[model samples]
Target chain A: SQQGEEDPQALSIQEGENATMNCSYKTSINNLQWYRQNSGRGLVHLILIRSNEREKHSGRLRVTLDTSKKSSSLLITASRAADTASYFCATAPSGGYNKLIFGAGTRLAVHP
Target chain B: DAGVTQSPTHLIKTRGQQVTLRCSPKSGHDTVSWYQQALGQGPQFIFQYYEEEERQRGNFPDRFSGHQFPNYSSELNVNALLLGDSALYLCASSGGTSGRAYNEQFFGPGTRLTVL
Candidate 1:
């Protein structure tokens, strides 16, 4: 079953602009992670935020989690053309931590 | 160190035939997980292996199964395949020592399966 659902199935933005994507999940999770997948390539781990963490940042990426609302958002600051890719949010259910249930990703196109 | 690596980058099989996809985990990693991603959709977890055992599994039926070798490599096998089974099969690896909150998964370029 799909655990997470990402909003704004697709987004287009110019370089240097900020891009944001939101995710909502059905059940409680131990942690939420964000990954980036280039065209026809594997997914790369980006950032992870625990249930207790309200927000976290890594370089140009900022992730916010609200366990109460079962929602999260990923923000990319100063988006670059290289940052264009499909971004997905995955949630590991509280009890089953080994497998991740992913969301339908948001495709972001950063035009240079 | 090499990241997760999968074999048979692309494969073609007919409905009702079986297929096997291989994966080698990153050095020093022991856990392996498999996922299926259909066109324009998110990946759905199939199962996971650790310590040469099936540690966890998702909602997939018995037709889908996997095995982990002593070397920490794994293979996903789909039996009695159906046309709807065609998708990109992904292999991911992560260390078991890292707690749930800190574990980071490394994924390999998925194997694109085309079921005719």
Candidate 2:
């Protein structure tokens, strides 16, 4: 079973527009990380936000976490055509092991 | 520094046969983990190896096993392959266990495995 679930299975937007993807998880996590994957390829780590932190930013990427709600959201500002890919949210449990539990993911399409 | 690398970009095996996939961790990394991603789904954790020992595992069956060499490279072996076992096998590497520092995992290109 998957611990995290991403919403809006798919999304499409213009190059200069902003894209937002949401993820909800069942268990408590020490941190939540977002990754991007091209077709049939491995994942690239985007950003990681710890449970203690409410928000984090990297370049044009912004991530917000609400531990109380057990949810997180990733926002890409000024999206580019190259940003088209699948985005996955993964959660690392508070303790036990450092393994990551990933969500199905959100397919984002950015058009020029 | 070289990133994580997996052997045999692609492979095919029969239903009753077995297959072995290899992975070399990135420079400065000491831990390796494996994942299986099916079409249109997220990657599922298979297991993790550190210090030449199996540290943690997911809900996979005993048929899925792995080994970590002294050099920190690893291999994933699947016995009695099934059609449902077909998927992209991904290998990720990270630094050794730190006291809850939230290490980031770097991934390899992955090997596409198909079972007939």
* CAPRI quality of model 1: medium
Query: Residue A99's C-alpha lDDT in candidate 1?
Result: 84
Whole-model lDDT for model 1 versus the true structure?
0.91
Model 2 score (lDDT): 0.93
- What is candidate 2's DockQ? 0.72
Instruction: For all candidates, state DockQ relative to the true structure.
Output: 0.70, 0.72
Model 1 misplacement above 4 A: B98-102
Native contact fraction per model? 0.73, 0.63
For model 2, the docking class works out as: medium
lDDT tens per residue, model 1, A1-109: 7889999999999999999999999998888999999985799999989888999999999999999999999999999999999999999888885589999999999
Q: Which candidate leads the pack in lDDT?
A: 2
lDDT tens digits by residue: candidate 1, B1-116? 78899999999999999999999999988889999999888899999888888878888999999999999999999999999999999999987574243477889999999999
lDDT of 2 by residue, A1-112 (tens): 8999999899999999999999999998988999999986989999989889999999999999999999999999999999999999999888745688999999999999
Which run of 10 residues does model 2 chain A get worst, by summed lDDT? A92-101
